[model samples]
Target: MTRSTPHVVGRLSFDPYEGPAGGWGSLSGMAKVVLRSGDLPVDQLMRQNKPGGFMCVSCAWAKPAEPHPAEFCENGAKATIWDLTPRRAGPDFFASHTLTELRTWTDYELEQAGRLTDPLRYDAASDRYVPCDWAEAFAAIGGRLREIDPRAAVFYASGRASLETSYAYALMARMYGSQNLPDSSNMCHESTSVGLTQSIGAPVGTVTLDDFAKTDFLFFFGQNVGSNSPRMLHDLQKAVRRGAQIVTFNPLKERGLEAFTNPQSPFQMLSPATTEISAQYHQVKTGGDLAAITGLCKWLIEADEMARAAGNPALIDHAFIADYTEGYAAFADFCRGADWGEIERESGLSVAAIAQAAAAYARSTAAIGVYGMGLTQQRFGVSNVNMVCNLMMLRGNVGREGAGLCPVRGHSNVQGQRTVGITEKPELAPLDVLKDQYGFEPPRYEGMTTVDVCERVLERQVRAFIGLGGNFLRAAPDSPRLEAAWGSIDLTVQIATKLNRGHLFTGRAAYLLPTLSRIERDVQDGRPQTVSMEDSTSCIHASDGTREPASPNLRSEMAIVAGIAQALLPPNPRLDWGAWRDDYGKVRDAIAQTYPDKFADFNARFRQPGGFHRGNPARERDFSGMEGGRARFILPPGLSAVGFDDAPDVFRLMTLRSNDQFNTTVYGYHDRFRGIQGTRDVLLICAADMDRLGLEAGQVVALETVSDDGIDRRKDGLRVTPFDIPPGCLGAYYPECNVLAPVGHHAQDAKTPAVKGIPVRVRP
Candidate 1:
């Protein structure tokens, strides 16, 4: 074995693994064993017979299969291991440790203690939390709310919350005359929602997983399936087996996307078997997705014009454009006028390469375009999505069997919670339906978004915060600012399954209430209960965890929300909280009645094997916009107006996820894709950049983040590792780097921080 010196930074170290012997020849042999052994628990989660089934709550990707006896992914295993760990943060633990001492603990150390046991209050005299009764906690919270201005209160929700819990929480905040409702979506897919809604009349993806299996071509933009959404690899593998051309456009060459071995396939482990996913891979610059996509559209139009002159059929879908789309001429004109030099410079893709991709797209009968945070966390995030929609519109891809748009969503029920009305800005139709069904007037004023809540707290407007499930303080951009904002709040309430960084950042009076994990059985009203999750493919299914609750005292998120509402609300004339709490079925009934067009017989339909898929306007080719057509192409202003201009010696830093971790939480330090092991403190740099800077592959360096507002946020002790990446670009892990992002530096329309693409200068 040829042992190489691994990179080291801070308290972490990275050691590369030498898989077997030979080069590409040995890859097939290694894959065979990986498939047979199914080393990763993620593959097992997708099989049927398992308690939780194949659905991943961490990332909403599901498929129909028998649940394996031991099912979970690396990240899922991390989530389960963390959840099932025999660690407890009880009243005795709190008594032994002061708030000051606990604050000094790392996020990993604090959560290692397991689950929270009882409600506790922070005593300023002793600077420690003491056990308090549930009633006292509620009353104290209510009293604080009554004392503060209504607008001064902020209620935040994490993606772990179920649809029922989210609805109740949203209702509680609105009824209390406050719109300070910040949610997890603000940091992730808010741009997808905003852009798709404006351009396509809906905020969700147009394609289903079935489409992936049937499509002739698959185009991935700014997404890493291996770490961000591993289940997606199964679909990609299927597509590759069917001879579908798979193309990937990302800043890094993700290993999972390059090749994958299906652990479920019996022959995979026994023989030299693996799927080659990316037929063509392009390493686009950070924040350059919009330009790359636009260039593809431009090439498509040019090809169509050329084909038309040859007396052959036009490359563009004229029938679909005429019958279903609007504003085609304007978009085509914009594409015609675009400069190739500008596109090449910004996207870091040669004109010939983009033209080849465009030709492939035009030749294919059906194609699907998928993207993730790389496109959404940029200055013109919404606009980038619009550009993608426009490309699909040009080819009449929407509402087709094998073609449409797919915004790979993060979190299991993030999209489901939004569908059930966890939004800060609820539509008029949903609000009206909710009021009519519940017999209460819903608030008319627009509620606070994630950014709004942070601003409110900074202005001393928000006094109290109640989180359903998430690490908000750590996940949100600008940790220092968020930490100070938390201090300004009078009371903080956290209803969580496990310990996270958010719990350590306490307010004057705080309570850490433990809740049942998603993988644990939830018993309500003397019966086991199962909650529904909506996957990225628009499929809604029931998830029942086999594991027992962490503790008897730990309640479901629904129960906790109900308890708080029952404690705080006056004897209400409308809105029956008691009926909803007795059984979750009542809440489903209300949902069915409110959204009859989509969620009819909500409870009954969810009992099906794979559940039911929601109505997809694009799948049906029913473009229900102002144009009264299918889908139309809308021209974006241009790439010139997108993102910040680079300065001398400044490289755009893009935050990424390791294979062993999820958002905000670090499971392990290893990143298997880049050959990194046992450490996340390494920075991926282009070889050219390292040579230019006179730096070696494993050199220790300090990363200084320069915010748009001229603030200097620095993270020291990052080992630089040279990799295959575009010049003028750098890569690092997130949350730890989230502090370097400016609080105010967000997408123009969506307000999502550009965490994936931030311009910065590195110091030695």
Candidate 2:
């Protein structure tokens, strides 16, 4: 592809001279960049930094450096670059661009503009957004909200919102008498939460960052760390250096797992001394993860039996099970009952492969099982996660250093939002505490989740949606359906740093409130402010951005949320909303008081350099659930592996991620790792599958939806590219491919849409 081809994946075409080096050095160097726009070296940026540096509002990953720098990761750079770009959307910009005109732009084009400068309201007659006073916008929104059925108002929270703002938003929604709290988590790791909560008492990861260095074996299932979570590469490298075995089970062979050039090593990047990541790579078929894990468990059980018969030490951790677990006998019985042929067939892996993986786990001193959305976005997503936890519990893997489960989160603050109580179902204790501390009874009704919100909107049961900071309409699945649903709403408010497709899909009396970017300074009560974020490891830290606000008219998310609350609630209310708005410390104080068990003295703790680590129940091996203690394995029912009666022409379509793109955010077109550039329109077909279908590389083919439902959602025109993938499994990008997915198809328990493994038929 020529340079003029409008690269979709920015990093692939990024010139080394345009920024820093391509790999780790570039990442470390960019890490120093202040959250703001100006170009400053790492040392200078750090020197000028106060407490709050530049925090990416998009993701909760904070750059809290003593001396803030302009450097960030490739994805971080993409986020920062997108944030710092010299673009604006003011009244005039909107005046010249009609809502109809803006809708014509692609998702990427819309967000490329820096920030929304003024609060905007859509005018039906003009078909354009007009600037409105903050008070007018707030009052208008409050009035519309009051008119809506309390059950109909769905309040969605993005990870980008500050902990203080998120709390205020949740409180306001509750006070308004709605339980509709749809969040990004519903789309990502709700399965992890559901599955883990069943096995252990919590949904978060059991291990901390410190555990990476201590773990002897690392099992990565259904995740591509290098592209999704690059910072994890550091830990993988560290573990490899320490002689740890990292086994990866994924459908596609990810480049990051094969070898990585540690930019930290002077010679590695300069030369070719790259570190190999995965000791054993298993290309299990899509939807075969559960079966693969089951096979491993079966192998371990057989090993334990063989060892006992040989008069040797017990292969399983029987002591741990007796002292710290429950349901062992049941789990063991289930494992014993698993048929080998069923395991092999369902897992799409051989019995020997399962045995090899099991032997590795049995011999390891400690093992950490890490996964991502790939494991969670399936028809059996919740069961898939439970099986992983079941395997870990059987071997007594929890509550120990280097031995736990890690669900890699996408947005940095996505995990943090949930940590700070952004949920549809807040526990009774937290609810009572919130009421006692704030003097208002939070709505006791269970709130609507993401899917529920979409369905409610479609049914006209939901009239207003106030988004803190996400491209909601586009971020969701069934975009066409969601867009139509959003259009039916009475009021839609988006507080964001940049223009996105969501902003364009506005409702009547819609408001686009501009907010301060994480890099910018947030001041209240004559003091600079910082927001706290909870990382994947359950580490809560303060994030302070260093850049100036894109526009002076922009307000911080906390201020915007509080302002809206003040407008909505009566003056003689239980909570002192005004006081909290004046001082963020007051908000933190409330948070501390509300979550005393988890966060004590939130203000003081946040002052600490790296922030504070929250206590994990599993970390201490405290399985605080039924049976009066220990974690237990919940064995699932076995089924004959579901396989297609091979029609010689049909191929299963597996949705994959391109290196240049994130969930719904496509940065550029090039997937350098996949050796593809300048296009997302191509499909990855196994060479053999292509041959059997009488197709070759670069063959133009149509993918038809093979669902029993008479829905034809696939685009009629798509080019096929023969690539390396397991036979019977084809690869395509998401959102585009999401059309082919049936709305009814989702995880049995978690309700997460099954995006990864979709069965389809190929056409010539």
Candidate 3:
């Protein structure tokens, strides 16, 4: 065999990017991805992020109340072009590629092959996908769904789908006698929903996009807002210009958090437009967020006690706590008694650092706490979230302008999906309301989520899987195991715009249904349709696709779901699937009827500028949803680690997306912010740890998971790169490192996979 030209750490570079975050570099990246899919109309690009145009389904960052000249980001362009690409995967392409051959391709290669232009089904004998009529595919799916017990089938929804589509799909699942409706939220922000709802009587963020301008302090914990939500950087820059303090706590020093130059500024284009993002940046250890936040709370409590002793105004919101919240006395006792030694050891930060963070927080009048998967994808994920809320509550931040908790969501419409009842666990009142409106008895059983679905599929409990969007195989944890379980299912249906690995890993029988993307116009019965989306701030807005359908065969997601419902359920005058499919307005009316108070005048409200704000009780300090009609300060299981007792040499492995990719879709191999290019196979480790472990910079190592489950989980051939990450903490690209995370390991309260805090032993 020829010498493999031994890879030498893949050209690791520490040269930081100094220019504005989104100037020429972002434009070039956007052009490269967009041009790869062939040229598009200028109107299509201009219409993106405009009022009366489509929302960028790239992220869930709240848009401005009004439209700007360019409201899109680099990732938004990538997502739009990735879906509306001119390249087509037709019969000839499938005929030439076999299942075995396609399985060998990388995820990027699989998706980059092209968009699925027609309905296709797996032909086991030929080991390739063959064309199938839409009616035949729908019939096969509906018939199989009917054949199995509804409890054995799962309906999965993705964030890319519209609100109307998700509502219809949820109704169909409930009508079919199963509530096994798991959506993408189960993987990303389930902890936020569980913790926030339990703590403050609401599951959504209270701060709107405009709140960034009025805040005194913004604390970002375990979130890379710049990389994940680039548009938010503009707001951070403005916050800094207005003399507000923005602090960041994370394992690695994300360059995006250090400084950002607003590309939209002309002054920045002429001179250095550098705006310091974090007034104070603290690098917290992996899985150490609970300890860190608790430490901050402890400092805040001590400061408050000292302030009261000095006859100063109370630092803690005593009036608000006494009147609006409960359990403060117990929570205060715990924080006052917290050990500084353990806090420092666990958080990997000195007492001074925690005090510094507390000082910034204490000095501010109004503050906002923001976080992402770094806090949520842990064994103590819910506790981590609750601690953040506890911190906000100490200063009377909840239900107020410029203050509250904000869990930065990854997808554009994931929040919207949850708002429209795309949950596995259906509330009894909502089910009753939907039943009364639709004239069908809805399923009342608690359904499976992402983690639960994985377990059930492995145990052969689930027989059929129907996905509205997203790459289920790649997004789920324990890929090798999930792939096997997914293949063993009786029937699998994927409704998507592009080809992903999920479509190739067929079940006993699988069908691929192509659907129109977010940017494509969905004209039902000759009238242009509009769909609503909820932002991170709980603001609802209408998104109307402006471009023509990518293909003549491509059907809208609503149309496909309606067709399936019509095929499965007998025709009925009360639940007329045909009329609803023909007119989305009727569907909106039904939504309003189902939740009259929340979605009043659905059509008219959706037509209003920036849509309309759903009534948020938390904003009005209405704690009726909570116990005893008051917000509760919950004391969670104090602090923990992921198999920390297993091995002394074990390191916490965090699975994160590179700047080049979204959740699972790889736009390119380069991560510009981290300065790595053309590869995702390198392991990022601290320089001190590299030396302590006796590993060279270019060494290729094997990562073996440290667990008590007795099952070996290992990934090999990862090049070691010494970087600025925290010691005892390692980072790797996801989907590749997903195999190292056991399916049994998940957040206790939320059931979200603990992908961020995997215990792994490295070997050269």
Candidate 4:
């Protein structure tokens, strides 16, 4: 229906953007999305993130209590317009293009083809997808699902699904007697959850949006605020204007963390002036956040002894450590005993750089630590979180008025889905309440994670896959392997808003069901339905649509989940699938019953303008939920930043999202911030590394993953570009470069694919 931004081989532009993160640059990008999509998004854009309006369906960044008139960002606009486009892939479109021909298209091309208008089933003889009646499609899928062992089925959830839909989906999975409910979290913040839970007895972050007001010092690690969450630039600008300190640690010196020009401000937009963001920026090596943080802890502990002996103010919170934490002795001893040489080497920073940050931490009255996927998608991702927790707790940041740890989550409502029982771990869910309410025993056994699903698919153990959302094959590691394994499944169902490459990776019996986006009105039984979302800050708010559906035949996610469940399972009086699908209040009521403490009066609380915070115990310094009833100081695993082989010839390649991309969804071909265009297949390597590898700039190069595992993961035709990254580090766009990250070589504890620090060798 429409052409996407073409991906073609071209000379790369490395002109550094001179302006701030958001200005006319961002506005122009948003305007382009509107013009190209043949859709007018101004009305919907005005309502996004407003009071009683639909939440932005892009990032999970929290909405402020007093939001700006335009609370959405450039990427948010792109996501909305990307969904609201007039292009439709109806029966005619499918008839014109065979499945084999569709498979040859790029991810951008496939998405640009348009949104699916009706339920479709894969036909073997025709080698294409044909429109089918909703009932017939559901019955066929249900019959196939019933034939398979439920345990062999994987129920995947994406972050775009509202809490109500995720709740119903979770119930369906449990009713089907399976707990393989792995969502997008497994690829990104799973390490945050696992590490935070082990250290502080809570899986969620402790910091709230208001903490920015009182925080004088902010420590940002592995997160590009400008690109990842541009709305965060507003808070950074506020903090800067108030003379607060923002110190950033990242491999790349992102423009957003450095400076910002708020698009909402007419004066700034008209002028050349921009607000400076970070007071100090440290370019740490890829996978070196652990060592960098450990160095901070080491410096503080070493300075504490000096201060105490000199009768100066103590550097660390000694009283808090003694009274509210355990294992401080072992943790402190380990840090003090750490070698300065190793810390400097592993962190890719000198002792002076580490000491400067430690000094700022020591002097700060209150501070906050913000991180993202960069810290979590590592070999020792859990350890990375524990170290961040250790650094924050050393200053008593946890439970403080203006200080805590904030993991900036990606994708809207990812955190909310986990809260509402879309999880592989049964212990995390209120299984007893689910049993009492639903009249079924919730699956107790631990289910397969994302990595486990990919691995099992090869062995044919996972026979069926029902994805609520997300491009699993593309987002996952070992793309070629997963894409090949995709067809081996017996049944695969995707409830999506638009076309993605994931739809083409069909199984023997596959169905693509178009669903209403969160921004579209869902009328059930003549009643306009509403749903809820939980932001990264744990603020639960209602998100309902005023815009009509893209297609008349499109169904709501809850309805699709219910349809499948009704066809597969026997009738049960306790579970009211029909009401939950239509009313949505019934779903929220059920969620409230499951987590009464958190979701009490779920329907009422979420109606508030800013919504209600789902209280976190860790913020209150309540460690009773953890072992030994106290926050524990976790010891560092090793002196090395990456807890893997340190081969000299191997380069550390970190997968990244382009400025115009989100996760696996490539919106365009250009990463404007990095000065690249018309392609996503460029490798960013430092000058020193380029010299060592004897590679010329703009030369197409290939990369082979260096792993002990027998599986050889490789990618070719990447144009090498010299960059300002750490000497041994390189950067490449994800999903395109996701091929180099082999399965099973992931964060074993969190099961997150180590996309950030993949060891690779480059060849021309």
Candidate 5:
């Protein structure tokens, strides 16, 4: 590996993500940013994320039935102010800046230019984007879409798009004869959807927010609770107060899991008070979760055998296993046969530690398991998730009160988008039901995923691309390659609220369509409209915006979808597109008509207080979707090692988000949790590896991927920082490091990009 340029040294503090001072720092930083935005309405700012007000656009954490006085977190406020800021980037702003010049701007700088005020299209003659009318923009987009085969056009939906908007978008795509519904989920939680459905016959989380109170033990894996799901801290505090044990597994010892001082707690407001979160923390190697789970099961199975030999009640749930599950005997035999030494070598955990965690699980009356992308973005992601279900099922955890599986979603409305038909595989939603309701035959063939879409575009198979909302270029793996591949398309359109790098990097013809944010009021046919969003717990609630649009020219996402639909397909007697656009209730009614059993009276139910729970059959011990109408304990193939199997010096790299960022959006330069300030270009490695490489904390180095594929994937100019991670593992912030993740390397069954567990080599 060869280094290109020296890295800029960034200050690293030894403090945790949040304590007394850290809590106040977060609030102060949020306040300063909000105030700098200028002249924000007092009432709207105060009531921003509370119930009966706009929902927070930050995360997908579930809210309590009764809203707290301060319903928002620091990141929530950042997202709110960022969306509702007074700054504007109108026609004049674009006229002064060329695409090449704009491409030189940092992600933070680009977004800080603020809300887009008008629709703009790239004008080759001027070498800049120029103002275009909504009608003209839609006409151009529709014309190009019609010229190409629908299979050649890709429709990408971001999680920020509301259920109503997504429903309309999905309908339009299928009506145009395409099921290329690639979405943010394909990059994030596709493994959760695939694995959970295979394990328990459901595609979403089975646990509710209230289950935290009744759970005796909570097993958390691969999630930074404080930075990602801040509001969850309160629930964790309450759970700790009630004597529930919290166990965590991660490569690094995150401060959020160690201890937390809730900013909203009255008791901690006056003085420095903190609550300990994880009672036991295991430092699992990156991509080593399957091995860790296998180890736990191995111990639990042995304990059950011993207990049964002693004439005691079996440690396992024999009754539940006999009645509602299949393949338990084979799974148990494999678990019992697993080598403890190999498990320890792979998982980076001692046999005693695995037994300790298993003992906690065995003693608990009920337990809940929670995980995130750390378990999903790997070669064996589905197997890892299935092992989690296997461990929980060993004790009849699923379908019981206070116990179930919770795959914490990273984005707001991601679950809802999938529920309303934003999926690459149309088979998930009944074609007969949609055809009966909308009088259109949805494509039966499975469409492209994120990686598949990129491959098609690279091969010049895809001609047109439309992003509902997101910086797809920055979010995907092998970003530079994807950027180049995008140029082959004839046209690209971005439905967005602010400027982003994706808008600058585009096809031959590109358009940026400004749209309303979550906090902006939307009106259709002289009546205020509300959008429904589903939380991580599958709770659907109505969010009505309060503030006026940042720009009057902006259109609601629903209207924009309708505009394009009308332009391409026009109105027909069978489907009145105008009615769906005029009133969102009609969209919800249509949703109920298509999926009547789950969303009965969708309009009436979503408006009710606390909203409605889209119940899962698996939650009630119903595994009818399986071949035998029982949950199957699918056996694992073997260990999916994080480090290279043959290369002794190879290191596993894990990509993560900074506390100051959300997905691909950079809110600031500081990462308070990791104690790094003002930079996002440092590599976190264990001190032993640092010594072996003879590198100092601020030493600049390059990383080159070690793979059988000859294509070189490298990230240069990264400063090395010694930290407490597994010996053979390293960590870096994503979007910057996304360049090293190969599009060809992804989860086996899910097809999600393998952002984590990339094998790499260090360069001096």
Candidate 6:
């Protein structure tokens, strides 16, 4: 454990990959999974992203019409193999490893143990989980739930659940008098939903997949496109081949944005050719996106004024703005007065780069602004999203073909969950529809979000915690506090597909309920079934699987949710739990009943090829939802979204996903795209910062948080590694670096934790 060594940081294997992403690297990643998956279900792999197949559980990227023969990406294949692995972590496996010992394992090692095969209940006497019958587990859980105040319980759902299952979960929570219905969006894209609703009068993106083919210019901010959504590479390639311009502004120079070679292409597999994705890549500082985007707005507005002064055709779309927008005068004034020196200093970019991006946008007839969590996870995440909207509305980029704001979501059905009423606010919940369909008034009290739930649990205000999916404990920003808060709860139930560290944090009464994954056949009522999911573009698709379930004891997420609802609520004709579980069609019918406008022909439309568009009115230029029937040009709160202007020698740290992992699940130890392998506990810092601190690559160091929130946080023994990140910033894999993002350090107005730009100082 000397300073020269990696400390607890596992062996660091570096391979600086030179070739473009998605060629040999993506193929090799998929091949390794296939070789390891004994008796692989090749049919599932072949049918993924196609009609009559399951949507990818990895991301929410839209599935195109007439998809390629192999529609799945490298990470999607790995997730499939991981879900369908022959290995099992059943009762016997749990009996051997005590909960205390299992806590010491890495996130990768814990999940790599394989899928769960049986229901497990924590044994307090033995300090280990033991096998339990579903009846007993459900009964005990139901009994404890019945004793507690329903309002004190939190029903958390994951993006992996189908829209049908999410609908059921939402209805069940309301039936039981709890509105604390928080899902994955609370942590990732809640800002996108909130900010867009305030700006464009809609909560979803206005851009459709067809928009990519027609856009003349695209502005990509903060998102690492290739690693998060490989399928999006297809759209980028088509846009480039159509002579469209793409500009990228991110702290790190992501390989996916640099160049891409489609793995499915026969020519790409044999040669070294690549399609360049970004025409101009600007390395903005972490939390600098607001300033950078505002700079664009300033340049565009000035250029427009100059064109008008010269008596030429106006650069701005005055007709569109007059007819379709509000607050133009005020928004224009703010941008006109913005100082270029401050923008340049804050954005870590030269005036020339900002001017270059502005010139490109000015040359295009249509443009789109695309972003990811890198923008939404900042301290001012809501404002970050509003700024992007402001930039779009300045030139009438929204509400036209190939022109709009695109928020690249991480989870597959996260947006769908929100569409179906998985919300904490009483105003956002479908209370009236539930009252109409079920003949009872639902609760109207405001409920808790992810952060609020964690705070309540820490205060012992929560009596029960139930998760439909996701690693709730590991995903929390302040790990030590939430881990203890989770243990303080009276009952904790996790309906999951695999083993993970979250399962090890046994509460007073805990149960690990194994459920079916998307890759499995969810036959119900003696008939094959299909569930639906909503992609990022508001398109709904039906997903069906042909492979067998991982274990006979496992049930579908819908079945498990229905069983719990039945066990807890009194019998009622309007709410027939058995019918909902017996046939997913009944669930869709109920959803349609709840939201006739969006799900009018739910089951029918979802069965069609490439499914149906749920219809975003924003795309058709409908702004009646906003005041004065027009989109609003929002003013940003300030120049810097991340407010640590005076913190000296502190690196702005953001959590990242390696090419080998998903949300909180690690598939391997390598991040081939970034050229780092064999470890997750390493901190990526720039060489100048290393020199400034008198440190070198491979030196084990500590990162202590610079916060006034009175939470003493530090991640020790992280091996320092030189990277191409902006000078005063650092990057590390998520969940591994989640401890640095304090719970209270979140986006204003939205509760998404500020994991993208945490202020910390490195110490050796």
Each prediction's TM-score against the native? 0.92, 0.91, 0.97, 0.98, 0.97, 0.98
The superposed Cα distance between candidate 5 and the true structure at residue 224, in angstroms, equals 1.2
Give the alpha carbon lDDT tens digit for every residue of 462-554 in model 1.
Answer: 778888888888888777777866877888888887767787778777887777877677777777776777878777777776666667777
lDDT comparing candidate 1 with the true structure: 0.74
Which has the better lDDT: candidate 2, or candidate 3?
Answer: 3
How far in Å is the alpha carbon of 160 misplaced in model 1?
A: 1.2
Off by over 4 Å in 3: 1-20, 641-643
TM-score of 2: 0.91
Better of 1 and 6 by TM-score: 6
Q: Give the alpha carbon lDDT tens digit for every residue of 440-498 in model 2.
A: 77787777777777667667777888898888777665566667667778889988888
RMSD of each: 4.6, 4.2, 2.2, 2.2, 2.0, 1.7
Candidate 5 per-residue lDDT over residues 1-764, each given as its tens digit: 22355323245443434453236766876766676566545566567545677767879888777777777777777788788888899999998999889987778889989899999999977778999999999999888888988888899998899888988898889889898998999998998999998888899888997788789899998888777878788788889899999999999887778887777766776676778889999999998888899988898889999999999877889899999999999999999899989898889899999899989888888899999889889888888889999989999999988899989898888889999889989778667888887677778888889989877866888888899998888888888777777778998999999999889877788899999998889998999999989889998888988788988899999999999999899566777778888899999988888878878999888866555898889999999988889998988778663424725688889998877878888877677778777667788998998888889987888888877867788888787877789998999988888888888879888988888888889987
Model 1: lDDT of residue 105: 59
Give the alpha carbon lDDT tens digit for every residue of 249-276 in model 6.
Answer: 9999899999999988899778878999
> Considering summed lDDT, which 10 consecutive residues are worst modelled in model 4?
1-10
lDDT of 4 by residue, 342-435 (tens): 8888889999999998898889989998998898998888888899999999989999888999999998999999999999998898899888
Question: Against the unseen true structure, what C-alpha lDDT does each candidate score?
Answer: 0.74, 0.73, 0.83, 0.87, 0.84, 0.87
At residue 189, give the lDDT of candidate 2.
85
Model 3, C-alpha of 289: deviation from truth (Å): 1.2
> Which one wins by TM-score: 2 or 6?
6
Total backbone clashes of model 6? 0
User: Where does candidate 3 have its weakest 10-residue lDDT segment?
Assistant: 1-10
TM-score of model 1 relative to the true fold?
0.92
